[model samples]
Target: MSKEKALAIFTAVPRTHNCAQAVAAGFAREALVDTLHDCGGGRAPEGLCGALHAALLMAPEDRREELRKRFAAGAGSVYCRTLKQELKFPCAECVRLGAALAEEFADKPEIR
Candidate 1:
């Protein structure tokens, strides 16, 4: 899906999505959409930002660290608490960044 469409899903009315779901939606990963159902709102493992967490999970194992580091650099931190309470990074933007990175990997897995 288009990035704008993915972002739109985040606050898409009654069927609004969470950070993780928004990233998964960008990839059109239906199974991932289900897997991340409860992984949002700071509930992702280690309290990682839901969007970052989902993006990392979607990436190839070897690229996960790069994805995480890049995300941290851009978003100020990978943890949801830090992003939200400390860095004041909005969740919607987190979703956007995560989806962007995931799409980057999906589009070109050999770039690294």
Candidate 2:
């Protein structure tokens, strides 16, 4: 998807440099779309935002449960921990950062 279109998905998310970079990188377009759909469909799992980000990173399924545990307290801040440590954006910026990265990654042509 185009970076603009990808960015549109994250319009509601707080914009940040990480998010902008993600959009520029095009890394997790489908995952972000799925996350929005799930969230909109009212079936988003607990700590959905963080889970979505982790999934997009291709985190192992076994790790997902553990990862989810980290943010199970309904604390958005906990969710941000991974993004902050991994991408240098605090929890406040995960949504935007994830979107940006997805867009950025998508815009890149396949290497192989």
Candidate 3:
């Protein structure tokens, strides 16, 4: 899917789905949505951002790491609370970044 579509999905969600879920579900190939849907919320199993967790689930290890590094560099941290509370990172910005990363992953078949 396109980055714009991913961003739309991320921002258009009606409820409080986490960034991880938004990114994962947004860029997921048709067959992967059901599995990736579970990756939403504030903090995932190990206190990771939902977007990061979802990326890990959807992408290969190397791709997931790349996404983590890129997200941390751009957003200052992968944690949702830190991004929203301490840094005051905008949700739209996060969604944009996540969508961009998801697009990168979506474009690479080896990464999926």
Query: TM-score per candidate, in order?
Result: 0.92, 0.32, 0.71
Cα shift from native, residue 10, model 3 (Å): 2.7
Q: Rate the local accuracy (lDDT) of all candidates.
A: 0.86, 0.39, 0.67
The digit string of per-residue lDDT tens for model 2 on 72-91 reads: 33333333434344445443
| After superposition, candidate 2 runs with Cα above 4 Å error | 1-9, 12-26, 31-36, 45-57, 73-112
Summarize candidate 3's per-residue lDDT along 1-112 as a digit string, tens digits.
Answer: 5556656777774853455556655665545445555555554666656666666666666677787888899889988778778899886677777777766775776624
Q: What's the distance in Å from true for residue 90, model 2?
A: 12
What is the alpha-carbon lDDT for the whole of candidate 1?
Answer: 0.86
Q: Considering only N, C-alpha and C atoms within 3 Å, which residue pairs clash in candidate 1? A: none
Indicate which candidate wins on lDDT.
1
For each candidate in turn, give its C-alpha RMSD to the true structure in angstroms.
1.4, 9.4, 3.6
Compared to the true structure, candidate 2 yields what TM-score?
0.32
Candidate 2 lDDT trough over 10 residues, lowest sum? 35-44
Best by TM-score: 1
